[model samples]
Target: MPVHDPYAWALDFEALGLVPAVGIAYSLALRRYPAERWRIACFAAGLALILAAFVTPLHTLSMHFLLSAHLLQNVVLAEWAPALCVLGLPPALAAAACRRSVVGTLTHPLVALPLWLGTYFAWHVPAAYDAALRHPTSLIHVEHGCYFVAGFLFWWPALQNAPHRLSGGTRALYLFAAFVLAAPLGLLLALIPRAVYDFYVHAPHRIWGLSPLADQQIGGAAMALEQASVLFAASTYFFLRFLGGDERAEAYRSLQRSS
Candidate 1:
């Protein structure tokens, strides 16, 4: 792709401002509650992912070039980055932040899961998706903003130990259910013979020589693969924790009976 004055290869500054804003907040939090090295690393990694998604040419490509690129960007905003950022929070910070009644209620699995799913599916609807792309500067930002916020809420019940934490078994079930519910969207997109979004169908130039249908399929497959990997890994971790807790409980009972 040629580097034109305004094109897919251009850098997007729309989300660039958030980097400094989030950095300042993190810096202040660090001063008050010293985070562990791993936490700091996770937080830094999350920010880096955000930059790669929105600050680089990838963001422009997503907006103009390929459906696969756009789907990959969405995955980062809605899953990978949010999970790491949530994991990066210090214990004290997480507790204090989640302590609010509104926060607790919103982040509860019952509430968060549906909201996240709704946002995911609603935005992917052809009409909405096309509209967002049509008004890239305005509606697209709104679309991405919703994804980011919902992502944080979606991961909170599974990751945080404050205000309201799910049991290991519940967390595993929560994640498993999320995967089951959300997987079909990707499958539908991949399996559909025709391109879902008109914007991509009418794109000025096809960068990778991929037909619209092929590009859509690739994007859909990527979405499914990412969700399966990230969600399944988290679910397995919690499920193992559940099993370990059960085994420990049984051991304690055995010791009590022996005494």
Candidate 2:
């Protein structure tokens, strides 16, 4: 397919403002604590992935053409980006942030799970999806912002690096629940007889001449695969930790001693 807007292909600085904002915070963070280069690198890499997903031609293609691209963008923004950024934080800072009064309530699995899963389904509602597309200026910001925040909250309570520690079993359960929660949505998207969203159905510049329904299914498959890969790894890690019993705890002790 011919490129849609050759002129519009210039680097999309406006959509990429988060990089510098996070970079500034990272620089400040390094000043206050030991400059563990790995942590800084993780944050920077997360920011770069977000840029690739949203600021590069991927953004244009997703917004203008393909549902697969849009789903991939959501994974980058809502899953990988937040997780990596959290991993990059100093443990002390994360613990400090977690100590706040509101953090206890928000980080609870009951609260976080619903918010993340609810936001995920809510945004995919036809009216909501179309509205975001129609009013790209304001509503789109709301959609993106909510996803990113909810994503962070969803991961915060389950991540090994989270300031507030969860029992291994609890974390494993959370990951399993997330996988269960997402399964139906992905299945519906993938197996639906026709295109669910009218927006993509009528979208102008489809790559590879893919029919809108096929595009929708592909996106759903992508979502399902991505969810499975991440959740499975996390769940297995925690489950093994749970199984390892005292062995895992001793390993952590050994690690701390070497460090």
Candidate 3:
């Protein structure tokens, strides 16, 4: 008789090996760049949390069948990873990197834009999603790569940390536009009546024993929530800046009136 233990199978070599390698490489790159020391620390911490999601036993257990677990994964990918990466930027490092011949060509808006959208779509497809579960190593590569590229594009305008920075108002518009476009993508996933991935649907269940459909709903919700959190945070920052500028202008007007 053969025994199947989800817990035991969760701690696979791929999960253990790939995360540390990627995390270390990211750290090394941070060291090479001229970012603030604190920002580098934040980046490292964020990557560690993100990587921990994959390498730890918790991720393994979540894969067996838990919508909450899946949500956690999406949160780490979209929100946590991007926020930390953006915090590390100050424009200079990005400008330097973009100056490289290969990077210059790659970072061109045309090239980076499509790669971001394509990578985002490709990984979510059923075939790729299923393949990721079957081969955890490949999953790490594709998933992390998608987050890295997507984060870069998503942060470029707002961070003003790119080789080119959008005007303040323009940055706000870009963020809103992204939020609107992304909302539909997430809603599409959430609204699907049937299971999109056979692996997830057929996989043995766990963590409150939620059904596959329920898990899918949670995953969609998770993505939406992640997007909302980021949009809100960025928007709030912009709003505050705008308000501060307005207050300064009003104060100047009052001084002129007194004079």
Q: Report, for every candidate in turn, its global Cα lDDT versus the true structure.
A: 0.86, 0.79, 0.64
Model 3 earns a TM-score of 0.75
Clashes of each: 0, 0, 0
Across residues 94-166, which tens digit of lDDT does each residue of candidate 3 receive?
7777677776665544555456566666777778777776775566556755766675665655664455554
Native-referenced Cα lDDT, model 1: 0.86
Model 2 per-residue lDDT tens digits across residues 1-259: 3457612442555556767887888788777765477877887887787778766777777777887777888878888988877667777777777788787678778998899899999998878987887775688778877888888888888863445577787889899999889777777889999897878887766678799999889989889988998987888798888887855787799999999
Q: Can you write out model 1's per-residue Cα lDDT over 1-259, one digit (the tens) per residue?
A: 4443224355567657787689789989999878999998998888888888886777877887788889999999989888889888898898887768898889888999999999999999999999998897799989998988899899988988787757889999999999999999998999999997999898887776899999999999989988899898889999998988974686689999999
State how far residue 206 of model 1 sits from its true place (Å): 0.6
Q: Give the candidate order by descending lDDT.
A: 1, 2, 3
Model 1: runs farther than 4 Å from truth?
1-9, 246-259
* Best of the candidates, lDDT: 1
Q: What is the lDDT of candidate 2?
A: 0.79
